[model samples]
Structures are given as C-alpha cells and as structure tokens.
Target: MTDRSDAHTATTPLAGRRVLVTGGTTGIGRAIAVLLASEGAKVFVCGRDAQHLDDALARIREVGEGDGITIDLAEEENVARLFEAATGYLGGLDIAVVNAARGAEGLTDMSEADLRYTIGSNFTAYLLSAQHAAKAMGAHGENATGQGDIVLIGSMSAYVLGKESTVYAGIKYGIQGFAIALRRELGKKGVRVSLVEPGLTGSDMVEGTSEEQAERIDKEEMLRAEDIAVGVHYLLTQPRRAVVQQVTISPRMQDEE
Candidate 1:
C-alpha cells in the first residue's frame, strides 16, 4: 500500500532548488530572489548596480545561501559570464527569472543610443538569457526530461497600450508572444516557460516617496514588489504534471491610462 504521506502532498516544495534571478539586485527581481531564498532555494543573482547587488546578497544570506555578481545582461558576453558564475556557485540551475529591463522613452524623444540600449535591455537580453538558461537546463539535449522553469517578468503595458509607452508596449507584446510559443516548444521536454505580467507596482521605476507608495498600496492603486514575488512563487511551486502558462497581476483599482 502506498503511504498516505506519499499519496497526498499539498504542493511541490522549493527547498534545495537552484535558482538564478537576473536584474535581481532591486525592485521586483530582488523581492523574488529574497523570497525564493527564504524558502531554502540556493539563489544566484545579477544586476547592473554594484551597491544594489551587495545589499541584495546580504539580505539573501540572512535567510539562506546565495551569491551574485554585478553585470548588465544586455551584453552577450555578460550574459554568458552570468550563467557561468551562477552554475559555478549553485552547481546547477533548476529555475531562472528573466526580469531585467530598461524603461522606454517616447519614440520621437529617443536618441539612437537610447533606442539601442532599450531594445537590448528590455527584449534582446530576455531572449539571450532564455537561450542560455534553456540549454543549461538540458531542454534541448537528448536527455531532455522535463526539468526546469523560466519565468519572464513582462508588464501589463502590452495590453494597456498607454500613450507614453509606445516603445515599451511593443517590447512587451513581443515578450507575450515569445513566452507562449516558447512554452509550446519546450513543453514536451519538461521545461516550463511562463510570462508574468504585473500591473502598476511600487518600485524604483515608479516615482514616489515611501509614504506615497504606502498610501497607494493601501488604496489598491498599486501593488507592492513583494506581491509579484508571491505570484512568482506560486508559479514555481505547481505540481510537475501541471503548468501555469501566464499570470497577469494588477491592482484592484488600476485602470488603463
């Protein structure tokens, strides 16, 4: 007879899982990294800011084991080194959160350099990191057993199509498409590709004081970065036989602008 303990597990556990979170030094990425680490995952993170990286690592170490580096994921060389460092630190990877991005400017206001950097950071980096992470997880290898999760942190901007977000919307629409197709492509191999679209959230990207942000959260006008982190954790803890393709989290009172 099968033991009752084995027959009825409430949820898949995250303990001892290996994870990488790019752009994890601040904001939503930082929250995700810290939350996962607190759950006992061995986390490796990267960010463009050295100070933020150090602070994030300190927070992670307080709860669980982790390491990190400072590097912009927009460059191919940096992305390569990031994975190498992650693998070396964690030994192997079971999950990756692709969340790094640059805020977009109006098309007419964007300079050539701004355009290039925004595209590279917001869109191209996601593709490149996904490529590396999939390969590392053996998604394409002969032994391609179902074995990994890739969560792309997209935005509700893809659907809202706000007036000031021409470039940002386009990139997010591209990510929405990429995530769905990638999931289908990798489904048979056991790698889950999911897109998480967050609504207005209080973070560095949003301009506000701590008190203002707190008020907005209280009013349900915005979400906390940690709220999205909880949503991500839900995605990662699903049963192996199941998959959550997408999650769109928005404040209860948020409306299209």
Candidate 2:
C-alpha cells in the first residue's frame, strides 16, 4: 500500500489541531490517530494495555506529537481522568474520537461481568468522555475556532444484522441514537457531533476469523481501517456551517442493505 502521511498532510485540513482518541492503540482508532497526527494534529490516545499503548505512542511519535495513557474505560475514574489528561497534553481539545469498545462473549448466556464490561467500555465510555470534551472545548473563549468536533465510531451492524453479534449491534444502535441527540444539544455551542459507522474492517476485531477469511476481507470483502479514518477526517474538517451527522462506509464488494 502507498504511504498516506505526506499525501494527507499536503491535502487535508487537520494541521495543528489537538485531538483525543480512545481505544486508539489498535484497529480503526489507531488508523485515525496516526493519520491525524501525520497531518499535524497533536494527538493523545488511550487503551487498556500499557504495552500496546507504548507501541502505539512509538509509532505516533515517529509521525507527529502524541502521547498515550493506559486506561480501562470501564472504570469511572479512568473515564473521568482521560479527557483531563488528554486536554492537558494537547493544551486544549479540538477533536474527540470515541472509538473504544469491547465485545461481550456471545450475545446469549453472557455473565454479569461480561455485560457490565461491554456496556461500560462500548456505550457509557463514549458518553462520559464526550461530556468532558464539551466542557474543555467551551473553555476555548469567544473567538474559538468553532467549539470543536466529536466523532463517534459506530458500526455497520447498527443497520445490518451480523449473526451472533446482536449485543454489539445493540450498543452501536444506541450509539447512533446518542449521536443524534448529542448533535441537537452540542450544535448550539458550535460543536458538531458526527458518527462514522464502519463495515467489516481488517483489525483485531476481524482477526478472529480464519486466515483465509481475513485475506479475503483485506483484499475484496471489507473496508480497511484507513478508509474509516477518512470518514472521520471528513466529519472533523468540513465547513463549520455544515453538520455531517453521520457517514457509513463499507467495502465496494459488500452488498448494500
């Protein structure tokens, strides 16, 4: 694949922006974080694993300014602290990408622990972080460059049925609803809320499949992480007057609903 760093820098509008991405150590969040950093955005990312956080930061630092913290979003304290730390590092907040989610092991027969963890990580985390984002951006003063942007990473499963993935789908469905409601409230403050729902993408989430299945998805069956990043960038960079409520992206080979 061709390197997108230089091309993205020369072409798009994310330079000098301060961004925070949750669950950004891998998968779609990683792609968005790295791409934004390469385009001159000071980014901060967080994940559950310290080792993965280190690895991601190394890659991000090679491209542009960035930092990472190991946070279990399910924990209330961590969720509260994340935005404050990220904003402190970036000096302020211009963009927040809500992309962290943990799947429950099978929809049926889930234990209480599985349900709590999944709900905390996938659903509640986004809401609490966005709340902090609103406060941070509001502090940007009267002449602030728009209040900022909140981009939620949803899933195509919100609209399409994925066998045995109903619990995950339900969380995404709630996210879509939350994103809509958020837009209604935040737009008055000059903050735009947008949702990017991605179809099957080649990431750790998709890695559970067989190798041949993964190859097919990478080559012809599904979208790539960078593709979803493109959608997120568009949402953040669009004219302040225009509010892009949501964008759904999928591989060309994936049949439409």
Candidate 3:
C-alpha cells in the first residue's frame, strides 16, 4: 500500500493532510470532517456517543479516509489522549478543528452543576484541546510533511446575544481570545490559528434556540451545518503565506440585532 499519509498529495488544497475534528459526530463538526476527508485528508474524529462516533466514521469513509473514537473533551486527559490516538491513526495531524461545544441558556435559572458542565464542555475543553493540538502541531515543525493549524469554532454570540445566552457567549469570548493569543505565541512555529464565528447555524445547538429562531431555520432562513463547513474549508485552503484569522458567517435573512 502507498499508505494513507501520501494519499492526498495529488491535487486539492487539503490533499494528503492529516486532520482531527472534534464533535465530528454531528452538526458543523460532522460537516467539516466529511468535507476534509473528501478533500483527501486522513481524518480522525471523536464524540461522546458511541453510535454517533460509528455513524460519523461511516459517513466520512463514504467519501474519504476517516476514523473515530468516543471521547468527552471535558476531561483534560481525554483531550490529550485524543491527540495521541489521532496522531497514530493519521500519521500526525496538520489540522485540529475545535468544533465540539455545549451551550447553557439562562445563567439565572441554571444550577451550579449546569454551569460547570457548560463551562467544561465549552470553555475548558476548547482550551485543553487547543493546547494538545498545539503540542502535536509544534512537534512536526515547519519542515514536516504535516504543517500545523488550529481552527477554533466560535459563535457570533460572542458579540450578538439571545435572552439566555450569557453562559454560551461568555465561554466563546474566552476561547476566541485564547485562540488569538495562542496564534501570536506560536508565530515562530509556523502553526496557523484561525477562529470562525458562525451565526444562527443549524445543528444540535439549534435545539436550544428559541422558538422564533427555530421557525427561521424551519423556513430555510439560517445557515446549514455544511455552509459553515464550506467556509472553514475556504480558510484552510488559503496559501501558506496567508491566514484568515477571524470571520463571522451568518444567514442572509436572519437579523443579527
């Protein structure tokens, strides 16, 4: 066998790159994973649910090289383990997509446990995952076949807000800031960092949206998971000398105010 690592060297921008996508079982994460694989990336993905993991892997395999494991990124060790396992499967990762996140609505009505869970899932997981991804990317160096990239999936909610989006927005603002700082610190390593803040995207996160917002989605007024994936791919394909550090994607019909 020629091996999966050498598979994508032929044509497309993402050809032959090793990629890791968190929350790959559903939503924007799944969309990103499938797209990357189709572009010839050796992709490994993770989710908390076993069935979702299998399903996502099968879907990715339908179009490209893909593997999966069940993981809860809330735990720091699990984040590290994910990187380790992915490195083995993909022959070291060139891209890390931190798209796994949970939202907490109504900080006023939510319990302490709920607060912790959201923070862990949203903020802490992102930080730890980026830390581990950065380490893996740094290990490869600029000259390595797999160049480095960390793509953080943030929410436009960092600037826009809903009635109960306090917790969710808070977490996004923290991680978004973190990604920018990490990019600065890693400038010497040639690892690219990008932040994508999407608005009113359709996914499991939509389940938490207000009925008014859901109505818009039902009417095809919001961005689909795949739409966001396309944007991420566009960012990923940019020349090595360029990077789209941050961008916000939104549905045309939806009002941001």
Instruction: Please give the CA lDDT of all the candidate structures.
Output: 0.91, 0.85, 0.84
For all predicted structures, in order, the TM-scores are 0.94, 0.88, 0.88
Best of the two (1, 2) by TM-score: 1
Judging by TM-score against the true structure, name the best candidate.
1
Worst 10 residues of 2 by lDDT: 138-147
| lDDT at position 82, candidate 1 | 90
Candidate order by TM-score, highest to lowest? Answer: 1, 2, 3
List model 2 lDDT by residue over 1-257, tens digit each.
98886654333379999999999999889999999999899999999888889888998989998998988999878887898799888999989999998765557768888888899989988888888888888823444434788999999888886677778888999999999998888887789899999987887776556576567776777777888988887777777778889898988788755
Question: What lDDT is obtained when candidate 3 is compared to the true structure?
Answer: 0.84
Candidate 1's C-alpha runs over 4 A off are 1-10, 141-143
Error of 3 at 223 (Å): 0.8
On the 0 to 100 scale, the lDDT of residue 90 in model 1 is: 90
Candidate order (lDDT): 1, 2, 3
Report the Cα lDDT for candidate 1. Answer: 0.91
TM-score of 3: 0.88
